[model samples]
Target: MIALIQRVSSATVTIENETVGAIGPGLLVLLGVEKGDDQAKADKLVRKVLAYRVFADADDKMNLNVSQAGGSLLVVSQFTLAADTNTGLRPSFSNGASHQDAEHWYQYFVQAARAQGMTTETGRFAADMQVSLVNDGPVTFWLQV
Candidate 1:
C-alpha cells in the first residue's frame, strides 16, 4: 500500500457535478493499493497516517499531528500512483492491484482511519472524480507499507 499525503487548507471531490466529499483544514490522501495488500496493510497505513506529525505546532514548528490539530481527512483512490515509468514507453501498471482488489483495500483503509477517530471522507470507489484543494504550505509526503 502507498499514500501521498498532502496537507490542505481546504479540499473537495466532485462526481458528475455533485460534490461528494469535502474537508477544511485537513490532509488530502491519495491512496494506492498494490497486489497482495490486505487488512494488515490497511491497519499499518491508518496508524502511520494518524501519527504522522505534519501539522504545525504553536511554536510554528512542524510538530503537530492531524489528531492534535483537530483536522479532517479527504481520501481519494488513485491506482496510478503505482505506475512505473522507468521503461522506454508506456508505464507498467502490473505493480498495481486489480481494480476489484484495489477497491477493497481502499475501503478498508478508510474504515481503519475512521476507527482511529479521524473525521474521514472518501471519493466514490472507481468513480470519475474531480479533486480540488489549496495545499497548506504546499506540504506533501509519501508513505509506504
Candidate 2:
C-alpha cells in the first residue's frame, strides 16, 4: 500500500458535479493498493499517516500530528500511485491491485482512520473524482508499506 499525503487547509472530493466528501485543516490522502497489500499493511500506513509529526507546533516547529493539531482527513483512492513508466512513455498499472481488491483495501484503510476518532472523509472508490484542496504549507509526503 502507498499513500500520497498532502497537508491541506481544506479539501473536497466531487463526482458528477456532486460533492462526496470534504474536510478542513487536515491531510488530503491519495491511497494506492498494490497486489500483495493487505489489512496489516494498510493499518500500518494509516498509523504512520496519523502519527507523523508534519504539523507545526506553537514554537513553529513541525512537531505535531494531525490529532494534536485537531485536524480532519480526506482519503481518496488513486490507483495511479502504483504506476510504472520505466519502459516507455506510457505508464503501466500492472503493479496495482485489481479494482475489486483495491476497493476492499481502500475501505479498510478508511475504516482504520475513522477508528482513530478523526473526522475522516473519503472519495468514492474507483469513481471519476475531481478533488479540490487549499494546500497548507503545500506539504506532501509519500509512504509505502
Candidate 3:
C-alpha cells in the first residue's frame, strides 16, 4: 500500500459538483493499493499516518502528530498512485490491485482511521473526483508499507 500524505490547512473533494468530503487543518491522504497489499499493510499504514509527526509545535518545529495538533483527515482513493511511470511516457496500471481488492482495502483504511477516534472524511472509491486543498507548508510525503 502507498499513501501520499500532505499537510493541508484545508481540503475538499467534489464529485459531479457535489461536495463529498472536506477537512480543516489536517492530512490529505491519497491512498493507492498495489498487488499483494493486504490488511496488515493497511493497518500498519493507518498507524503510521496517525502517528507521523508533520505538524509544527510550540517551538515552531515539526513535532506534532495530527491528533496532537487536533486536525481531521481527508482520505481519498487514488489508484493512479500505483502507476508504473519509471520507464515510458505512459503509465501502467498492471501493478495496481484489482478494483475489488483496492476498494476493500480503501474502506478498511477509512474504518481504521475512524476507529482510532479521529475525524475522518472520504471520497467515493472509483469516482471522478475534484480535490482542492491549501497545503500547509506544502509539506508532503510518500509513505509505503
lDDT of 2 by residue, 1-145 (tens): 9999999999999999999999989899999999999878988998999999889999999999999999989999999999987899999999999989999999999999999897899999989999999998989999999
- Model 2 residue runs over 4 Å out of place are none
Q: Write the per-residue lDDT of candidate 3 for residues 1-145, one digit (tens) a residue.
A: 9999999999999999999999999999999999999889999999999999999999999999999999999999999999999998999999999999999999999999999999999999999999999999989999999
Score candidate 2 by lDDT: 0.94
lDDT of 2 at 120: 96
- Relative to the true structure, candidate 3 reaches a TM of 0.99
TM-score per candidate, chains pooled: 0.97, 0.98, 0.99
Q: How badly does each model clash, as a count of residue pairs? A: 0, 0, 0
Question: Candidate 2 versus the native: TM-score?
Answer: 0.98
Candidate 3 yields a Cα-based lDDT of 0.98
Root-mean-square deviation per candidate = 0.8, 0.7, 0.5
Candidate 1 or 3, higher lDDT? 3
Which candidate order results from sorting by TM-score in descending order? 3, 2, 1
Lowest-sum lDDT 10-residue window in model 1:
82-91
Better of 2 and 3 by lDDT: 3
* Backbone clash pairs in model 2 (N, Cα, C under 3 Å; residues 3+ apart or in different chains), count: 0
Q: Write the per-residue lDDT of candidate 1 for residues 1-145, one digit (tens) a residue.
A: 9999999999999999999999999899999999989888889888999889999998999998898998999999999988888987888899999999998889888988998889999999889999999999989999999
